[model samples]
Target: MRARSTVLAACAAAVALLPAGCGGGEKADDAGASASPGAASAAPGPIPAIKPADVKPLVGRWVGTAKDYFQFTADGSGVWVRGGQRLWSGTAIPEGGGKYRFSWQGGDLKTASYWGVSLTEKNTKLLFAGTNQTYTKAVAHKGKGKG
Candidate 1:
């Protein structure tokens, strides 16, 4: 009898807590419920693609604010450095349109998408669509030649 009573109590408690455990309130509209004003709730818009030949210009050091930068090589590998420390080393493979798939090295093997390289005589910019970050090409510093 005691065992049966304990079982009944447990079942009652579970039933009482079920509603709270789930999102058991009034249903909210799909659009307005979760999204804040002026915020994007859906995926971002498509980025413009560039030809494969255009990717050649991307092979160089690009710098961002706070010492964050990326160094890409002709072989398609690159490294992401932030605050003078190497954070992620990966391969930026051109995906045939302006997009490049940045595949990080390691067990996790995370990947990011980058596109939109705008180049001018004085400046070059690479846009990372995921975070909406833009990195400018870093000009090589010239040293004084031996006199």
Candidate 2:
């Protein structure tokens, strides 16, 4: 009779500990819910493609004024102004790798400009590591139209 009680008590202790052990870990459903869909999974629908010509509309003179105003001409030349000082001026040359090299002269500064990939129609951000400045501006065309 004593042996039977001891076995029953041991089994009860194990059953109580089992719930605590399992609950201590993260729940499987929570992990699955937070996971993102696989990138290689089948496409839900056709993806629209943008051609270079479609991007041509973005090529033009864009001007803006706030703390500073800048004029960016995609054709060949561009300029930026702040506090009556011309911050930048140069010729913009577009390359294949979403990059543009600009040869500029103005504001006691002279050098070639480096522009990264275009972000949007109205906004273009440029980073100058030498100056440690990130320039962000909303551009407006001189007369062609709005972006």
Scored by Cα lDDT, where does model 1 land?
0.48
After best superposition, candidate 1 residue 34: deviation in angstroms? Answer: 29
Q: What CA root-mean-square deviation does each model show from the true structure?
A: 20.4, 27.4
Q: Quote model 1's TM-score.
A: 0.48
Best by lDDT: 1
Clashing pairs in 2: none
Each candidate structure's TM-score, on Cα atoms with residue i matched to residue i, is 0.48, 0.35
Model 1 lDDT per residue over 6-123, tens place? 5445434423432222221122223323321122243222223434454677789987644467787776556766656554454555654455654422111122332223334443
The 10 consecutive residues of candidate 2 with the worst lDDT sum are 104-113
lDDT, each prediction: 0.48, 0.35
Error of 1 at 62 (Å): 0.6
